[model samples]
Target chain A: MTHQRWFTPWLLVAPAAVWLAVFSLWPSLNTVVLAFTNAKPLGGGRFTGVENFARITDDAQLGDALLNSVIYMVVCVPLLTLLPLLLAVLVQRKLPGISFFRTAFYTPVIASAVVVALIWGWVLEERGLVNGLAQQLGVLSGPLPFLTDRWLLLLSAISLTVWKGLGYYMIIYLSALGNVSRELHEAAFVDGAGPVRRFFNVTVPGVRNTMALVSVLISVSALRVFSELYVLSDGTGGPGGQDMSVVMLIQMYSRGFTGHLGYASALSLLLFAVTIGPMLLLLRLNRKAA
Target chain B: MRKGWLIPVAAAAAVLLLSGCGLGGDGGAGEDVDASGEVKGKVTFQTWALQPKFTDYVQGVIDAFEAAYPGTEVEWLDQPGDGYSDKVLSQAAGGSLPDVVNLPPDFVLPLVQQGMLLDIEGADDKLNADYVTGGIDAYRYTGHNGVYAYPWYLNTDVNYWNTELLAKYGLDPAKLPTTVDELIAQARTMKKESGGEVYLMSRKPELGDLANAGVPIMAEDGKSFVFNTPEAAAVLDKYRAAFAEGLMPRDVLTDKYAGNAELFNSGTVAWTTGGGNYITSLATDNPTLAPKVIPSPAMGTPPLYAQGLSVASGSKNLPTAMALARWVTNAENQAAFAHLVNIFPSTKASANDPFFAQSDGTPSGDAKVIAFTSLAQARMLQPVEVTGAMSDIVKQQISLAISGDASSQEALDAAVEQCDKLIGQ
Candidate 1:
């Protein structure tokens, strides 16, 4: 009788399982398979196993993109992780208009990416507010080539991502901070520990689970930072086309040469490996913390 | 009278036969359909546009098509512009695409290379007999042999000027600028006349997407970007000169499309580029705003250029799609489309129409002269080559130069390096 009940339950879940297997698992499997084949979007072609990956590895543009991606992630994640924690701490003080500050930080995350990008484009354009103010303040005589120069373009894109991520991540940190035992902070204060020490030693340790989750989120976010780069650099990435992300590279391969679908699939697998391999390691560490 | 009746019957029979051949060619090599005889099924068009815009145009075309072929119903799966080509490719990969799709000209060749597009060369020939030569070529992406795309509508960029502003600045409405030098001189003259109360010309008018559009004024060869070339430098120098000389305000770069158009309507900007294929409607749409068209003066050596449109190869309904495309380019329909769109027709016949030649005599100026001059020496967007990095190079370099972040040379050099990388030069 129990076995019959278990069969019905399995049967009930079969449709959804099948749906995931077909839509998700199948496509992923296809991506991995096609990575080794010279199959195009429309017509089948010869197998070119490891050739696409070898080409990507050898390509100078991909190298630049990879370097840029690393630099972007390295620069952005720390700021994204720490800034929100600080903001959450500041806002958690129950000071005057703290709710307003919290709302302000959260507001940017709710705005559409396109709107955010457009507004940022204006603020960062050659003669935009930053330059104008800098000029007025005698900080610089001319505007920075924020989107034109490869280095500045990467920096600008990362900073914009940070700005957009800051508020949302801050809210998350705040919720986690709220869940921290009030007794811990009160005890830390009783021990004559300074605010900074308490934050680093006690507060951080308490929110370890949230930190692990948010770190993974930020890491993945860094890996897929497409919109900011696309919008800022007008989809060319940047000058010398050095800032094109792996995702952008995949898009170009898929689109520009529709006949090169196999190569694109290969690139897709490469991206998946680059993104998930590290992500899985982080997940393991996160599991260890539990 | 009997001879005329025979000609009519013959013409009708010919169209039917041609349409049939077109349908057969599109439905794989051996697949054939008797769409002429009581065809009843729903065919969907996959294209780039949101629901409202897509629905309106698709519905309009479908209604016309269904009225002509009663048993056919057309549905739409509107793809957003973002990741549009990718969406189409994914469909192609899965061997599933809508019956028709409006493909960007650049995507046609690659799709054709994938053997995705139906070879509608024969049907295209019929369309070419009626459509403008250049317009047809816009759809001919293969350079030779394969004709993958059909020219749906022809668009050409032109100069939209404030006639009232020109006259106010003691400039003759008939005498538009013919060269880069003349354009600069006109801006200077207009600024002095206006006493710096308004800009002589706006760099980028803050209009919707115009701010980020980054339309580059490049060289003729399309091999080299001129935005940083001496000629481009000269153009930029003239712009910077205009700003420095107080002929144009530094703030002009902040102007959007609406602001720029408004500037012209309010007699501020002396001249600017008109909305391609929709200049006339821009005027007609705003009856109170008096604006006129002028030919875009040669910034470089020879003829001026405009962007073009082409059908996508991924379309499943190539026969009906080609037929509908032909309908948009036919002399009568071209005239109607041009009249409705309020822009110059690509075809010489419609362009040379008495209606286009003789202006409606609106208070702004002679619309016909404006239309004709603008169409006389038009160029087209450069073909996708070197990984299709031309547009990117042009946009980046031009933005740098315009913003004065980099000298014309530095920007051009950087752009050249990028292009070289893409082309493997």
Candidate 2:
């Protein structure tokens, strides 16, 4: 009898449910469907199953993109996850004006990515401040080509990504750090454990769940690193296509020369598979860990 | 419990009712009840004019268009100084394209091939004959059924020199390089004479500034890449030598479009190939050390070139768009735009517009007359099918070659192979 009345609660939620179904869920499903076909934004294409996947496999540019994506994930994910934790712990200390330090670190998040890239581009230019400073300090006889050279290009882009993301993830860890029982650190010290060991055993495990959550978040972000590369290299990626990633390839596929909507859809589907499948697997692992 | 359920159920019903009412209200509000099938609508117009130097004139013209056409609104959209093309293409793919847009003249063929444009009324017909003969041709693509854009304006590349820099280097103030070889020699001379303080010449090695030159770097025949020829390599070799001689920075290969401009304005670069408006900008921004504009040194023969504008084919109101296009190219409007912009006008009649006559405070003299005659000879890049992919492939490979990562032969071979693949597709 009580269950009969609960039907009204379900009915009341129906409109929001319908809204999400139409806008979010349906579009995502359509993207997957279109990815399997040669359909364009204007529509009209026949289905082609694993052909897109096979084509992505054979494409040299796509291969390069996949490699770059993996590289970004491998380098950026752990650094992004760990650096923020370290930064949060350092800032959370009762050092004077810790609040001001937190605000200063978070400020980059408020600035737009394009602006950040532009500022960094200037700082990294051949005669830019970094090179000028290095030369003045007798560090090098010549300036380093930050945007042009492959090694430096990737280094500069990754550094910018880590810098921009630090404060945001710092705040996340900061919140988690707040809930850590202070008594645990005291007990560890009473047992005569050093500060470093106490931090590793007590502080780290105290926020293990938050660290896991942020790791997954950073992994997903690493999968979609486009704007920083695009901004640094003026849309073409770095010279010789050294820093080009999958998202840039997807963009080029969609609207570049031929605007092969079908090809782009195929690439999109492949990208979705690459990004989401692993993310879900990781989430499942996280659940198991929990 | 039953009463509580009623509250949620009533809320859901209210939401459904409110949405239905909203939809109905929207449909009623914008209904065109007038007998005339007039679409009083707005269309976005995107352009790359951003600097305080150029944006005002562009915005002024757009404003004039909207003012002239009472019902049709023209929204001006400006791209930022960097990553302008990337943003433009992204906006196009997202299908939030401005109804009207301007791409660099050389990019017209690629844009058409991508199906980003809509067919217009005046592409191939006798209507195109009314503008400069070759102007409409550049905006046409074979893959596109009809003309996709209308010819907007023409500008010619000229050599700009700081007479102060030239005089200080012990070079003649009035004389300029007359041939490719002569330009190289002068570049070397300027470098040595200036104690390596100034770059005698500054331009991107990819020859982007030269893409508009009247002669094709590679001919229309797809079989061979002409830019990889001995003559073009000779040009690149000169740049390589200049770079080696410390006339230009070794990292010149990495400099973006504005790097040379900055070098020129800052007085570190003595002479360079620059846009037509450089002299005007110099006079306006840096009056004391205003650079003198002169004809480009001959490369076999003096060739002329300029950027072109076109109307998009996918426009919803074709006639209105055509009207706007025609109006912009008309003698009166071209003259207005010319006065406002100080670039050469598309129309012959508008070339003599008082704007150019009074500009530089120079009277209708031989130099002005010669500049106009050169405009007549000015040619844009020919419209080629498969240009979009072909050019990108060329750019990619050439960038590699310029960076010393690949040989010229390897780059051209890769480009040709890529071009073949694209053409086959």
Candidate 3:
């Protein structure tokens, strides 16, 4: 019976294990191997003893890319993780047509990026909705370049990203909000804590785990923010072309379009390091906070 | 029509029928023949972005090919021109490429450098006798003697000005700016005078445009960056000033050429640079602007073969693959396809056809005459082994300069260093 018990669990896990091994583990392992090679342009590649890594030292764009990625994370994470929590709180109340509000908030999350981009592109153009409203409101003298000025374009992109992502993180926080006991809020009320204080003292503490998880998720999303950038910039990273995230840079290099697969592989492994390292660090930081 | 440079036309597939006697003469003579002296089995032919517009015409050619050759099948696959290089690389890696594929020569360089393309030159020399020498030679990689792709059509860039916009900006349509600096100066004055209602350029002008200002991309030996001089920095400074002063739209950094076309037709910007075929688009999308559209001969250098068709390297059916390549690029078909899409046929016969010589005095008609003559002075923009990576590095530095993050001298110096490291110079 004990041996049979092992067989059933092992058999159940086998499919998933095999799936990961084939799709995820093998490619990751291959990427690490490729990182050490010259890997392209006739004869494939040979083991080159860290020449690719050495090239990174001379790469002029790495610093700008890193800076842009960090800026993207900083801009995206708080807007996604924290603002959604506040939104979830407001929409969480039992009220008439609350579901409608929730659905409206979540509609952007459900919308495809293409649709979102089209909407945003029109909304942010010189004569588009946002600028027209501004013009009518007499907030500015003339039409502003919402999608044209580099800095404004970046901000516009950030706004679009946050807008699209808000509902998803809100739903996550809403689920977390559901788990908090009503008794906790009542007890806090009895203790004379105001609504804001009660939120800080009760609901927030309860949803701390969800907050941490959402941070990591948004961080990963920010790190891989190519599609949004692609749509917003019409495929050129805006301004300095520095709007492209680190992963896009990896794709631009790796796809052998440029015949720099070995160097690209090295960059890929570097991406793996950057992505995985932060996730692990976040986990550790959360554990320590707990 | 790429607002961007990501998909430059497939560079090496020019072909001519001559007499149609022995187009693929060396087909059965090559390796991997089955001793039966026949080219057989399923052969896949892939083309880029020919759907809806050229699908029927392409199918017609395929039908003719199948009728002429018994026991042989050619399946055609088509993909859009966007992100084509990435698609080619992924396909190459997976080994899912068609037997005969079309690629712009510059875009095909990475694959060629990998030695993954078959030696087409070794198979057919006589067939290309009447083809443009530049078309045939464009695919010749630096170290390899093998010709990678056969040239097809040329898409020479031309400056299309919105004369209405030019007059609106107080600039004369008769006397256009002949150089990059002059264009920017006129643009700056126009923007300032118009109270910032007009934009001068659609995108940040790069090395190609700067080449018009006499900025060479590389030295005479083609071994290193030639933009190390004061002249180069001065040219870069002009572009940087354009962007900083809001002469060029911010969207130029990201918007595709399609987006730029929208802006141009809307009369938001004064002019754009594109193939002569752009006038046709102006005629269709914005007819009001079509009559106002004035086409100028593309300044600086041009290359032959905006699109090319080539056989895959490790095909089990090379003979069939070569046959399809030759058949599609025959003089008659090339001329017909060129007529359909304004492709410049590389064959002498196709070029000399009365079809090309005639002009109806329309803007498009004049533009065709210009696109035809533009190639006469074009020097093939040869793809060095590390073309993509080198360009990426330089583009980044130039972007930084355009954004005012770095001086032009600093930008060009960085380009030299990074390019040197990549090419091991």
Candidate 4:
């Protein structure tokens, strides 16, 4: 009976355990192994012993990609972390049509990233809506190259990331806000604390942990961004291919005759390393806070 | 309790590690086949994005082939256009490629390097005489001697101009540009006359353009890129000067720029290059602008684009697969297929067919006649060895040159250096 009990539990877990081993754990290990080889997409390769990693140091494109990621993370972390919380607070109360507003705010989260990026591409084009309006109002003499200039293209992709991320992070904030003590809010109100003052002292402190979590999430996503930049730049990685992210580089090396699976795996490892920094920092900060 | 749980977990890990070995196995080179055997067996045929619209046409071909060759069966697989390259690579890696497959010339290069495609010429020498010389030459790689695929349908780029847009911008449609220099001059005139309200050129310089300007894109040995020559730089400089003068749109070099066809359909660009079927497709997409389109022969040696059927080297039914590949691309079948669409047939017998020779007096018919004539002179302007990665490098460098971020010579030099490194890899 005791032996059967152990075997039965194993049988129950076998499907999920096998799935995890095959999909997640195996691919991760294979990536580490492949990083040391020169595997092509069509399958023949040999171990080159850190040759791919060595190539990374001299890669100008990787330099541009890393810089783009830093800029993306820097701009995204603050905007995504704060704006969503404000949006959540605005729609948190059980007022008439609050559900409608909440749904409207969250609609972008449900939209496909490629579809969203393409829509944003048309909106930011030289003869697109924003430029036409800006010109009509006499705000500018010439159309701004929103999708052409390097800096403007990067800023446009960043804006898209923030816009698409707003509803998602807002929902996370909404759930965290519900856990804040209503009694503390009432007590603050009785003491004549204004909305802004109460928000700073009570609401801000209450959701500090959630904000930390959201910041880390935004930072990681910004570093891993591909579709927004890819679709916006029409997969050319913007002018001079300077707007590419690490993930986009990985994709570039994983397709067609240009594909180098080993190199792509190496890039994947680099991305994992880059993202782990913010994640580990978050974990340490959360531990200290606890 | 710990030991009992560990046993199952360790067993699972072992199984997974063994399975991983299978994933890393090489896509083995197929053994040579005695393709002279009787054509009898089941063969898998694959086409790219040809279903629904051409289902009846393809099915009729298959049925006719089957009836002609007794004891032969063909299973057809039509794949969607998206992610087709990835799908083919995966299939090749697994050694599960179809017996016969449709692929573009560039797409067949890596497979040929891997020995995944059968050398059709070596299999059947007589088949070579049936295809047009240019079509046959397309499947022959620079370093490889054998033709890897049966030449199927061929098309060449034809220049399309919007007469209405040209008239609106005070440019004469009757005096349309026929050379690159003339095109540039006309663009400058249109820009100055329209006050930059419309554009005549909306495309960046690609490898085909460089080749058209007499740049030796690749070395004679096909081992290195030599397009960094003075002539290439001179061509780029001309484009840079035009770009600086705003003859082309600023966004044309960026990803935000729509393709020439889309811009032409919108009446924003007065000139664009498209295939023989371009007007037909344009009429379907934009009916109002169809009548205003005028077709002209492409400037410089028009770029030839060919789609061919390649038999997998490892096919179980090698004889039948080879036979089916040949039968489908035969002059009769090719002419029949061409009749349904504006694409030119690749077979030599179909070259002088009256159907392609005569125009029904419409603009689309004119495009057909022009394209058919262009096919006679068209060559594969872009070398088959230029991979996607190399193209990306050229695009980025040329963009930087046109945008004045780098000099034309510097950009071409950088592009050559990077492309040589890629080929070396």
- TM-score per candidate, in order? 0.68, 0.75, 0.85, 0.93
Candidate lDDT (C-alpha), each: 0.60, 0.63, 0.73, 0.88
Instruction: Label model 4 with its docking quality class.
Output: medium
lDDT of 2 by residue, B334-387 (tens): 666655544566555664555454435431122344455556555543334434
lDDT of 3 by residue, A91-134 (tens): 99999999999999999988898879877887877778988999
Q: Whose TM-score is greatest here?
A: 4
Whose lDDT is greatest here?
A: 4
Residue B10 displacement (Å), model 4: 8.2
- Those runs of model 3 whose alpha carbons end farther than 4 Å from true positions after fitting are A1-10, A40-43, A74-81, A142-154, A281-290, B1-42, B66-73, B212-215, B218-229, B244-246, B254-260, B302-305, B381-389, B423-425
Scored by DockQ, the top model is 4
Candidate 2 interface RMSD (Å): 10.7
Model 3 chain A: ten consecutive residues of lowest lDDT: A38-47
Q: Is candidate 2 or candidate 4 better by lDDT?
A: 4
DockQ of each: 0.23, 0.18, 0.38, 0.50
**Residue B236 C-alpha lDDT in model 4:** 87
Alpha carbon deviation, residue B278, candidate 2 (Å): 3.1
Docking class of 3: acceptable
Model 4 chain A weakest lDDT span, ten residues long:
A1-10
**What's the CA error at residue A191 for candidate 4, in Å?**
4.4
lDDT of 2 at A90: 93
TM-scores of chain B alone in all candidate structures, in the order given: 0.66, 0.70, 0.83, 0.93
